[model samples]
Each structure stands twice: as structure tokens, then as C-alpha cells.
Target chain A: MTETVEGLSINLATVRQQWGFAEAVEGCLRHGIHAIAPWRDQIAAIGLDQAARIVREEGLQVTGLCRGGFFPASDAAGRRAAIDDNRRAVEEAAALRADCLVLVVGGLPAGSRDIAGARAMVVEGIAAVLPDAVAAGVPLAIEPLHPMYAADRACVNTLSQALDICDALDPPQTGALGVALDVYHCWWDPELEAQALRAGPKRLMAHHICDWLVPTRDMLTDRGMMGDGVIDLPAIRRMVEAGGFSGPQEVEIFSAEHWWKKPGDEVLATCVERFRTVC
Target chain B: MTETVEGLSINLATVRQQWGFAEAVEGCLRHGIHAIAPWRDQIAAIGLDQAARIVREEGLQVTGLCRGGFFPASDAAGRRAAIDDNRRAVEEAAALRADCLVLVVGGLPAGSRDIAGARAMVVEGIAAVLPDAVAAGVPLAIEPLHPMYAADRACVNTLSQALDICDALDPPQTGALGVALDVYHCWWDPELEAQALRAGPKRLMAHHICDWLVPTRDMLTDRGMMGDGVIDLPAIRRMVEAGGFSGPQEVEIFSAEHWWKKPGDEVLATCVERFRTVC
Candidate 1:
């Protein structure tokens, strides 16, 4: 049973408002959660070297880096800038010895209606940064956000679409490029099961667990805890495991009105409880 | 130019609060827009008979009826009740001589986690109502709402998924069943163009036009006017046209903060101008 709890990981954004990177690690450790995923902003706050040092000193298992994508832009210069930024993210993930660098590949560029063009840039951006990721021995996990984010946050909005990109870039089922399946984003997809099967072990890199609130008050920040919302966490987790991923199930809730207001220790404890019984 | 205007239609919900059924039709006529789609509430407010008389008297084209779906329920009685209401809606659509009866099929029933079960109910509900729709000579246009509404508004959230339902119920390409292709709902779908082609002339029943705002303020009512958002109106129209749907490009904007507060005539005028210039 403790081994099952050991497989649980906390995404720092779940307690981001309450604690910085180092404090969040301490909080997770107190709750007996040794695995974590941190957002780039959180790492930047403590400085990458300090964050990496803390991870090494604590012997923490870095599940995945929060993000490294947003590739779309209105012009060639902006696209190049995104690619360069992604390369830096690859180096940072490698420095942390993280399992994978997750990508929330961007949506339509500002004042641009070209979703297809944005998607094209996402492919180009990932391809451009693939060499850096390969050199650093860091995997890239394309996190397909829910369809609601299609317009402004991510054009890659399905497991199938993410797999299509992987097939295009790393066709031989290489562990170099893969997907970070977030249940909150994909629980509603009718094709989820089939696509999960298609993703199979090598391509399915990270498994994120969160719930979809019934009356989702806010589009971005109103994510529910594992058992609180409508997602069948065990069911999705079963599919994920069947597809060959045995990594820690990272909890990544972004509830602005409720959970974020709680104390960091309480939040970590609740995550641990939910991870055991519900997840 | 008048011929193009003849192909333009207004969904009365765009100015629903400002005008009743008759007034909205009169407003559409004054704007040189001969076609209009009315919701059930608007139709019932002024009495459907009177609304039908106005449509008949003015020779106004009833492009499509607003809705007729919400089939899932916790109990058998509730499911049966929904089917009965849908039958009544078919009768209403028949009375108005609308080209098709649009179905914004309901989402998950209360406290239900089984989206697949909810989807099965939708298919069964549509099948139950198919005979009445066929009898009334009203085609059932399954409008696949955007995936954001998958939880509460409509489970059928993709053109392909809707077409799959249509295929199951009316396999012969019988005009009795088809899809109401709404750009606002499907513009983000990467497979949209291909699926529109799949819907082709026979099954492409209706084409709905609206823009997706860059920063959509609300999930239900923050829709932009035709050219005000990021949707490539001309591009989607071209796909719909190529798919063999020569129906009016119905402008359905649920802009609570913007257009709905305006006068009905002003809303209709803007619809005309945007329809001409952008759509």
C-alpha cells in the first residue's frame, strides 16, 4: 500500500501559490511523496541551479517538467525565438534529470486565425528542438490539452493528434518523442481508449491525473482533484498502464477558488489520500 | 449581391432578448434577409401557430429549428419524457416548414460518469425520434457542439461522431438524417475539412456561421459576430459549399455581452454587413 503511495507524484502547480519550488519539495516529502513535476516559472523563481541542487540533495524523482512548447507566432522571428526557448527548456530538463519535458504546444498566434498554420509551426518547433532534446538525453512529451484550449492555448488537442505528430517525427516508436496523457484534458474524448492503445508503451511517456469539474467555473484554473469530479481515474489509469507507462501518476490540479487557497501541507496530504483511495 | 444576401440567414438567438419571433422575422426581412432560425422558447413565447403564420405570410424561409435533443436520463420515465418532447419539437419544425430540425443532443445525465452510456442514450433517443422526423418530412440535423460542451451541453461534439450516428440511424443517405455543421463548434477540428467532405451533398443538411472569440469570456454565450473573432469564415464556407450544402449560411451568435444588448434591427444589419464582407 505504501508502495502504491510511492508511485504518486505532485505537480507543483497544485500548490504553486502557497510554496516556492524548494518549499513545495519539502511539503511533498513530508507527505511521503518523493516524486514531483514543476512548472518552468517555479524553477525560474528559485534559479535552475538551486532547483536542480534541491532535487539531487533530496533524491527526488522528477517525473516530468511542466511545459516547453507554445511554438506558434505571427512571424518567422517569433517562431525562431520559440524554438530557441524550447532548446533552453530541454537543457533545463536534462539538468534536473527529469523523466520528460512536457509540451503544451501553442494555439493560434496573436491576431492570427490560422489554426492549421499554428499546428504546422508546432510540428516545426518540436522538430527544431528534437536534436537538442536528443543531445541532452531528455524526452519530449507532447501534452494534448483539452479541445477548449484549441483556439488560444494548444492546437494539439487529442491523443490521436499527438500520436500523429509522434509518428511523423519519430516514426520508429523511439522513446525520444512521446505524449504526456493528462486525464483532465482527454477524459471526454470518444477515441481515447483506441488512441491510448495506439500510443502503447514507448510513446506514452507521462500520465497526468486531474478531474473535470461539473460546472467548470474557470476554463484554465478550475481543475478538480482526482475523486472530486467526473473522470474515471482508475479506468484511464488502467488504459495508461495497459499501454506500458509505469511512472508516477502526477496530480496537476489548478483550482484557483478552492484547492489553491488551502495550506501546502494540507493540499499534499489530501493529494496523498486521493492518490491511495481514488486514483 | 441580393442573390448572396438571399443565401444569408439569421438565427434569432443573436437578438433573442430584443425581439420575439414575429419581430425577429420582420427584422430579418427589413435587413433583406429572408431566412431565419428560431429557438423553441422564442417560438412558444408568441405561440407557434402565430409564428408559423408569420413565416407563411411573409414567404420567409425557415432555415432550421433551434433544437430537439436532451435524451439521456437517470430513469426510464425521464428518457421517455425527453423522447415525447422531441416528438413535439418535430411537429413544431414541421409546422414551420423548416429545412431541418437541429438537435443539440444533451450531455451527461445528472450524477452520471458514464459518457459512453450517455452517448448510447443519445443514439437511441435520436433513433426513437427519427420516425417522427421522417414522418413530418423534417430532417434531423445533429449539430455536433464543440467539445467544451461535452459534459453538459451535448455529447455529440464532432462532425464525424454525428455522421456516425446518422450512418447508424439512416444508412441510405436518406434525407431524414444529417448534420448541422456549425463552424463555431467544429472550426478547431483538424479533420473538419475531410469530415465535411464525408458529409457531402446528401448528408450536409445545414451550415451554421459564427466566430470564435480570441479570449472567449463565457462558454455558453461569448460568441463573436461573424468577422469579429478568429474563425476563417470564408474558409469554412468554402468547405461547406464544396460538401454540397447550398443552405443559407445561418448566423448564430450568442453574444450576451455584445450583440444581444443591441436592438434587433441593428443586430440584423451587422449580420448582413459581416455576412457580405467576411462570410
Candidate 2:
């Protein structure tokens, strides 16, 4: 029963525990979801050419290639290595014809407490990969992670901060650099609305949806489905839409204990139902 | 060995697992720490009069009361109850002659996703208790919890947001309404330095210190000791000091797994050692 659902996408990580690349895509198709965002490892597993072939043949909308950023390092060699890897990610994103190459910029260097230094490295790393991304016709979407992940994941923890990076690098709003707004990471931000408005259509690249569970069991993977947690999804969606992004709202959940243990078919069905009603 | 430490104050919660109010005070005194912050329950357990007597007799500087804010409620009656309780907290602070009545303004109302509404409720609740606080000569210090706790603990999640509330309620930068800056909650903020500068001395009521451990085991009670985590404590202290706040740097740790299970004397010794060296 494949009935196309508009303005809806599934981030493969949501059902990562239940299915592989091919299986997840098949599951999404079964659920009438045509848009998707796939992690680099998943793409690697199926081979990028095969993934691209599948994407092209099925006419699937590759919302984003997740991800390519870990800029900060203890040394210059490590930084250069990260930039080199990001460039490869850009090429893969280009092959997939994705809307953007999501960048979860790295946090503080190993055993280092200097967040400012890490941020500077992120900018430099992005600048290094900008030309490659531009040549490949891929936009770099800086996904600012939640502040809880400031120590290890992504140091860019606010939309304002991400936008500031964009404004600094791509002053003309060329769409080469933008931000991925995830409600799970950004719903609590005081400046969310203002920052969304500031992002506008040109810089607001992607909109990811997931609920913030009240007791959030695991910091890494304890996301709740839409309508299951406390995030005001419609409100955030309104903010993103108002900012000019008319893209599919990508469902990205990383529930290690609950959803991950469920069957892929059930997860997809639930996502579709929730997307239709709550989201 | 009671050589008084001039600028170190202990928030009794660091030793909450091992000692109650009087014993915690005695522990602090033994460590040559003459200042302490006590939770309302701790004060109540020891009888407020007796707690006040101990502070007065021992010449212990009550740095700040542990808390007095949980504004947002599902109903108007609940909000009124919170305000009434805050008034009592003000009286208690006044009796203790503490520096300020720290307010951990609460999060979303049950079954509701209205963060803005919760924040508004916080402001209204604070306003309702402001007159009593002023009359009792107990300054209100709004402590913004980390964004992770924005769901169940506090909706006010940034120094900028807390300051905005203070500014709206008391435009004159009155010492009566201020912010309690905690490194654990705000170390990742990009506007931290700017906000600290903006707070200056008048608006900066309390300075709480603790480390943000990597792989934080529990969101509520897994804080690290001074030198154990990645937080740049000295750098943060420099910012606060530059903001014209020369008050004691109050050590507050909620380590359920590690520090809480240790001996109170060991924790005090480690705190003093870390405060002198790392902080």
C-alpha cells in the first residue's frame, strides 16, 4: 500500500537497529515514505554506487547525507585528516544528489577544555571543504547538537552560533553553507524563534523532528517519537516554515532501549501515523 | 587545623549523602570552610531556628539558600501554592541572613509542551514573590539550569534568558533581582562571556562551581569534582571576577555514584585541594 506522503522524510538512524540500508529503504517504500537521510556508515555498507543507484532508480529524495564534520583535533595532521574526510563525504553526498551534507562539527579536542579553540577549528575545517562542496554542488548543513553533547559530539549548540558561522563563511547567502534545525537539539533554545527567522529560507537547509523525553534515559540515544514526548513539534515546524524552508520534516530518532528494539515495519507505520496527525 | 579559607563556600548537597545540615556544617568547619548553602529540606530537618542559631553562633556565612523556585504549574492554584511557598523561602533566607534566595525556576507543566508559557509563568511567579523577597531583604537569584533539564527541572536554560527575566522584572539592575551563574549549567554557552560582562556585580548574585563530566552517567546527579572534568573552571572564574563579582566560588556537586558514596571528610579535602589548584 504505497501512497506518497508529502513533506515527510525518514532519517535511517531512526530504524538503524532494525534494518540495514536496503531493508530500511524497502521498509520506507512500504510505508509510503519517499524521502530519506542516510548516515555515512550505512552508505558505506551498501556501497555508495549501489546506494546512489537505488536512490536514482526509485526516484527517492535524499534529504541529506549524514554527516561530515569532526574538525577539532589535538594536532594539525588530525585537523587536515578531518578536512580530507569531509571532502570525501561531500563527493558521496554529491553522488547521492542529496539536498545537503550534514556536518556534526566536532567538540573539544581529546582531553582539551578549550571550546573556543575547537570552534575556530570547525570554521577553518568548513572553509577548507567549502570549495569542494561548492564544486560538487552540495550544501554544507551545520547541525548544532544539544549543549549536553558540547563536551564530545558537536560544540555548535545554538542556531545563532551556527548561523554566525554561516554568515562569516558565506556572507552573500549563497546556500553553500546552512544549518540543519533539529527540534531535539534546539527546542530548548531561548533564541530559537529569532534565530529561525534570522536563518530565513536561504540558510535554513533542513528540519529534523524528534521528541525530547522528559527523563531522557540515555544522552546519546533516547529520543521519543512525535506526540510521545514534550517537544512542541508544530510550533518548531511553524518557526522553520516561517523561515522559508518548505522541505520534508525528517524524522530522526535514536532510541536504543525502546524503538531500536521494535520491528522496522511497526516503526515505519508509527512514524507515518504520527507524521500525519501530530507532526 | 581550622585555618579559614577566605573565598571557598560549600553547598551542602556535595555531602548530602553522608551528612545532614549540622553535621555538614561541622564537616565544612573542620575543613576550614566557614560558608555553606543549605537546602530547604535540610534546614527543615534541623529546625530552621537551630540552623539559624548554628550560623549565628559559628559566624558561618550562609552563601545562599539552596533554592526557592518551581514556578510553572498545571493549574493556577498550583502556581499560587508555589508563590506562597516562595514567600516562606524568602522569610527563611532572611532569617538565615543568606546572600540570596536561589531560584531553580521549573520546567513545563505536566502534559503540556508550552515552554514559552512555562517561562512566562516563571516570571509571574518570581514577580509574585518579589515583594516578599525585597521586604525580607533576601535577593532573588534566578539559577538557569542546563538546557537538558528544560523539560522536567527548569525551562530557563541560559544566562541570557535568566538575565532577560531579571531585566524585565527589575529594569534598574537592582541587587534584589539577580542571576546565579553555575559553570556546570552554562559552560557551553557562546554568549557566556558577554552575559557575564552584562551581569557585572549588581546582577550577579551567586557563583556556583562544578565540573561537567564527559559521559555524564546521570543528568541530575553525575557532576564531576573541580579538576575531574573538561570545564575550564579557572577561565569561568576569570570571567565572573572580571564581571566584578568577588564573592566566594561556591562548590556544588551532585555526584550520586562517586563523590556521594565517599566519606564527607575525603570530599571536603578533595574540594579544598581542587579549589586551590584547578579552580
Candidate 3:
């Protein structure tokens, strides 16, 4: 493990299988990794108060909360429920003093096939929660998932697409909206460097890093650790820097087979090592 | 079957496992399928002469050849080999009088991280072979694979990207260069409709259709049949048709688990049924 890991954050989901919120906080703290992001389920699993106490007591920087966006639905009631849930997520981000609420804008709803409609729902959903997020002082970061996930995970599948929403919802480069650029989700984008540069500082809220495996066995998990796969991390980092984003490069991996099965401390240690050398 | 599909073409890949080239052709013929797009490997297996003779004897409109590009390489020598191979593919396409020789432009070369560089090689490779293809009266249809294949199978992963290559190689709107727009590869693209509009008439060489399974078990082999997954096929077909591509919607399923295991006759029957009803 690296002796120092400044400017790097460990998103708890990277080692989610081995550790819960509190345990992950302790594990990262043991590895000199303070900044972290937790999913709502993780927070809920440990109770918000305890999770907050860990953050407060350890003086860990909450890079961003894992999520709060599944905007598309089949009907008005479903939309209302999504918005209400987003509001709760906004409150959670506020409570945790998170850098932003990372929004995995959802894909087409069940029994529906209109991607444009799902995208419209995402825009409306983000707009519905913008004021609350602004009031809570928690920025919203729309994480454009990879196109493979477009049908089920997120319809907004490109950085340019996310920026379009950011533009539509918050026109003046308002601080309340931005993007969480995850390399695993978007490393293959030809316009990635350009889009990241277009994001600029105000809109580039978070940067996530993980390698894309060549034979990605599973669509959702099976993410490779840094340096173990094909992504040119430093090149993307150069693009991010050129784009004017100089924030924590959070290590957010979902390796259901490899890292998830390792010991939490070992996983944290490897993340530290990879972030220092590869990411 | 709803009995409305007279123009649907069954790409032999949809039922690759159930039959060899001749068998698939016979099966398609039995079901009144007058069109097919056989993979180069399958054609080679039956001997190109036999395949071409069958096409001539039966008078089939081979909508498009299955493939002819994997241009990226670590060195110039390898690239030259790719060009030479493409020339051979062009000849085969000519032999079969296929509408176009589809190009799945290559991804990064082995141990290489520069996708942009790899893409440059693809463009250059295409430029080198464009003359031969044009001379043979075989249109070169650049078929962009999904982004998941960007690292290994294809770096050209969007219709816009493919169209960009076509425009660069054939700026005069020449009929020799065009795109084989596959809904499975490009359905997630936000600029899909606009790109289709951009690729009007002569530039739109072919249209490939297959559903993106909700859980695509294998990234390369688990493609679903039309109407079986999340893609809105009729909508994309509408856009392509509006763009002046009156080509048959070619079925190109690669489902190792499902379709590949089905009887070729049943699969062709299913394709005809889906073509009339769902597609």
C-alpha cells in the first residue's frame, strides 16, 4: 500500500461487499483514506446518525453520496414518488455534508420503450429537486452511466447528454448542478475529453476512476482495479485537469468477483496502491 | 406470423448455430426468405465459390456481408495485412453481389492504450482500401459496434463516429461509402435520429436490427431477437426509413444460449413472424 494517498477518495461501494458504512469508514481511516462516498442503502443499513457520527468523528470528507436519481416512471404517481425520494436523498446529502448527490438518472421504466420519454422524465425529475438541493446546499451530479446500462440503469448515457441536462435545468452554470465523471462508465467515449473540458469547473463536481476490463464478464460488476485493465488513467486525468476539475479522484469500483471477495483492509490497501500508481 | 413481412431479411447470424451457410440458405429459402447476410467465416467454410453459386442460382439479395474490418494494429505491417484482408472481403462481397461489405472498424491493438491512434489507423486503413471496393462496385458500410466492444472489437462505437469516418473518407457523398446502422449498437445514441438524417440515402447502406437483452449475458454473443428486448425497433426503423434507407431490416442475433441453440427453420420462422408482428 502507498504511504500517502492525498487527492484520492475511496468510494465505499468499491469494497461494499466486505464492509458496511461504519466498518468501511474505519477501514479507510486505517489506510489514511478519509474522503468517502456511501450509498443511501449503506447509510440506511447503519442508520444515518451513526454514519454521520463516523464522518464527523473521523473528520472524513464526504466526497458525494452514492445516488438519488431514477427519474423516469410510467405515471404521475410514480414520478411523484421518485421526486419525493430524491428530496430525501438531497436531505441526506445535506446531513452528511456531501460534496454532491450523484444521480444515476434512470433508464426506460418497465413496460415502456420510449428512451426520449425516460430522458424527459430525468430532466423533469432533476428540475423538480433542483430547488431543494439548492436550499440544502447540496449540489447534484448527474453520472452518465455507460451505454450498456442505458436500457436499465441510466438513459442519460453520455457526458454530453448529462451536460445537456445540466444546461436545461440550470442555465447559468448554477452551483447546484454538475456531473460525476466515472471512467469505467465512459472511457470508451470518443468525445469524452472534449465533453469533460466542456464541463469546466462549475459543472465538473466529481471524478470517479476504475479500469474497464477487456472481457468484462458481467455487465454490472466485474470491474477491474486500476492498472489491471486498459484505461489510460493519467490521460483522462490530464483531460480532467484541462477541463478545470482538480478534485478528489474517487475510487469507485464494483468488482463483484475479485475485490468484493477480498478482506476489507486488503481491498482498501489495494485501492490506495492503485490510486497512487495507476489512477 | 402476422403475414405482413415481405421485405424483412434474415441475417444468417441470427441462427448461425442451427445451420452452416448452405443449410441456412436452404432454410431461409424454404421460409420464402430471399435475403441473407452470411458471415465471412461461414462463407469461407462452404467455399466462396459455392456460396456465390448458390446466390446466383437462387437469385438472393445478400443485404450485406457480415464483416470486413478489424483494422487497428500495433504496426504498419499488421495494418497492411488488414487492408489486404479487406481487399479479399471486398472480392467476396463482389462475388456474392452483396449490397455492401460491412466494416466493424477495429479497436485498440494488443497491449495498446491509444484508442484515438487506433481510430486513426482505421481511417487510414479504410482509405487505402476504398479504391478497390469502389472499383469492384461493392459499397463499404462501416458498422459501428457498441461501446462495450470499443476496447477489443471496435473503437468506432456510434453512428456519428462511423458516419464521421465515412464523411472523411468520402466527403463528396459518394455512394461507395456508407453506414450499416444497427439498432443494437446505436439505439442508445442521443444523436441517433439526427445522425440518420445526416446519413441520407446513398450514405445509409444497410439497416441491422436486434434487441438488446435486458441482461446481455455475454457482451459479444448474447444479442436478443427483435422485439424480445428493450430497443424500440419500429421507432428506429421509422427514422432510418425517413432518412431514405429502404433496405430490409436485417436480423443479426448472436445469442449463444438462446437463438443459436434453436433449430434454423424455427429461428427463421420466428424471424419471419417477428418481422411481420413485432419488428
Best by TM-score: 2
Q: For each candidate, what's the DockQ? A: 0.74, 0.91, 0.81
- Please give, for residues A112-228, the per-residue lDDT of candidate 1 as tens digits: 888889999999999999988999999999999988899888999999999999999999987999999999899988898889999999989899998988898888999998888
Could you give me the TM-score of model 1 versus the true structure? 0.98
Better of 2 and 3 by lDDT: 2
Q: Identify the runs in model 3 with alpha carbons over 4 angstroms from their true place.
A: A1-4, B1-5
Pairs that clash in candidate 3: none
**lDDT by residue for model 3 (B28-53), tens:** 88888888899999999999999999
Q: Report clash pairs, candidate 2.
A: none
State the fnat of model 1: 0.60
**lDDT at position A26, candidate 3:** 78
TM-score of chain B of each: 0.98, 0.99, 0.97
> Which one is best on lDDT?
2
Candidate 3, residue B95: the lDDT equals 96
Q: Give the poorly placed runs of model 1, Cα more than 4 Å off.
A: A1-4, B1-4
lDDT (Cα, tens digit) per residue for candidate 3, span A182-253: 999888999999999899999999999989888789989989899988899999999999999988999988
Clashes of each: 0, 0, 0
| Displacement of the residue A89 alpha carbon in candidate 2, Å | 0.2
